[model samples]
Target: MKNSSAADSVVLGPRPQYPIESVDNALRILLLLGERSELRLTEVAEYLGVASSTAHRLLAMLHYRGFIRQDRRSKAYVPGTALTGVAFSILQQFDVRQTLRPFLEELRDETGETVHVATLDGTTVRFIDAIESPRAVRVASRLGRSMPANCTSTGKAMLASLSTERLHQLYPEEELPGLTEHSIRSRAALEREIAGIRRRGYATSSEESEEGVSSVSVAFPAEHSALRLSFNTAMPVSRVKRADIKRIAELMRSTVDRAAALLH
Candidate 1:
């Protein structure tokens, strides 16, 4: 994921000579939440390298301060109003979402399927924007959600653009975390898939990230663009067929080409 907890987020400056442990730990949790939309107490503990009791205390303080709020059922800590307000302000400073939203809307209109514009964050892919399909029985929007890159077409599309050395740095281990039985489970398997995506110039997923959700994704071209995002169209499993893929891939590729032109 985009976790410093996992990916060592750039710290920007030398370590402080007189660091306060509690304050540092609290900031680390916030950083992790920036990469992940939700976190659990156990995950917080492991990420911070702290005891369960200590992690709980930090989470309680943040929850009290309204930086985070626990889900009613899941009990996972999610961004609260205060944190979201800050994030919204930061997003305004970077106009990627504003720039690509129209392409997402047009793709949804053309395909009558859910469309998303997502960017890779370390080993994760975060859905930054989305447009829902008009159909009553369509895949739902995954806006603001993050998942393993190898498991999603959006993530794979972006990952395939990375150099081989970069790919190794991201997946140093042979074993990979799987969301479902169909997810790519080994680094070898993932590498093969990445190679295929590079040749195909697009990517596809069939219930790998989530059951009943299959998608086609084309990474926005890098030409004249620094933004690394993908154009994705998702549909229910029953609605997807082999014949549907070539058509969807063509639309995804053309749409991304047009969106990429706007970056200049």
Candidate 2:
């Protein structure tokens, strides 16, 4: 999995009423394990945007819970019995990631950009899976990360399906936090953009969530008030021409349509 360069990445979604930093950090550590067989203390610290000592405590707790085990020699933590058991149980039921990865892969191949499958998680959008573009210059995958619904094309695409009252409820604040200067910073702006998304059947962001990155996205299960889903093709803003955005958005819209049917 790929991540934004920012080490101090915060949850960009609507702030939780009773957020627990420790639990969130520990969950982040588990997410990192999905991309590698093992993790070092330093890597966890950097990824979680925490100090090495803080990372160590989180790792120790996970190790005690049988979710991870530190290798005696390398001091790297690997998945443990409890984690494996949970994975086996989940996979046996149905692997949503496995079922949807091919669609993202196809989108990446068509657009020559990183493709992500994200789901609405309350006021946030969670990237459940992603396929990175193989190009030397391209946006990185965003697997297992969540961002504000209005800050990302993937999030906005889904948010467009929601009613104004619903959106207002989700974003009760007049002012919204922004990751970059280009991000939507108010409820009115987001609602206006969402109106355009509804008209265009797609959503876009130019350096909204991250500097120098732009993306075009389409949502599935069109207008679903619940379980709204979406995918986006992200690339360097410099490489994103108007023509390319149109081409990519068309392809993504079609792919998402098929995916919505298949998933249903």
| lDDT (10s digit) by residue, model 2, range 1-264 | 323433225356886899998997787788667555478988888777778898899999999999998765556787777886576445335655677778888987787788887777546777877889999998887887879888999889988876775576567777987889999999899989999999999999999999999999898864331245788889998897899999998998788777776665
- Model 2, residue 177: C-alpha shift (Å): 1.5
> What is candidate 1's lDDT per residue for 93-138, written digit by digit as tens?
6887898888888888889999988876668787888899999999
Give the whole-model CA lDDT for all candidates, comma-separated: 0.83, 0.79
Global fold similarity of model 1 (TM-score): 0.66
Regions of model 1 farther than 4 Å from truth:
1-93
- Per-candidate RMSD, Å: 10.3, 16.0
Candidate 2 — which pairs collide? none
* Residue 18 C-alpha lDDT in model 2: 100
Residue 161 lDDT (model 1): 87
* TM-scores of the models, in the order given: 0.66, 0.64
Which one is best on lDDT?
Answer: 1
**Local error of candidate 2 at residue 135 (angstroms):** 0.6
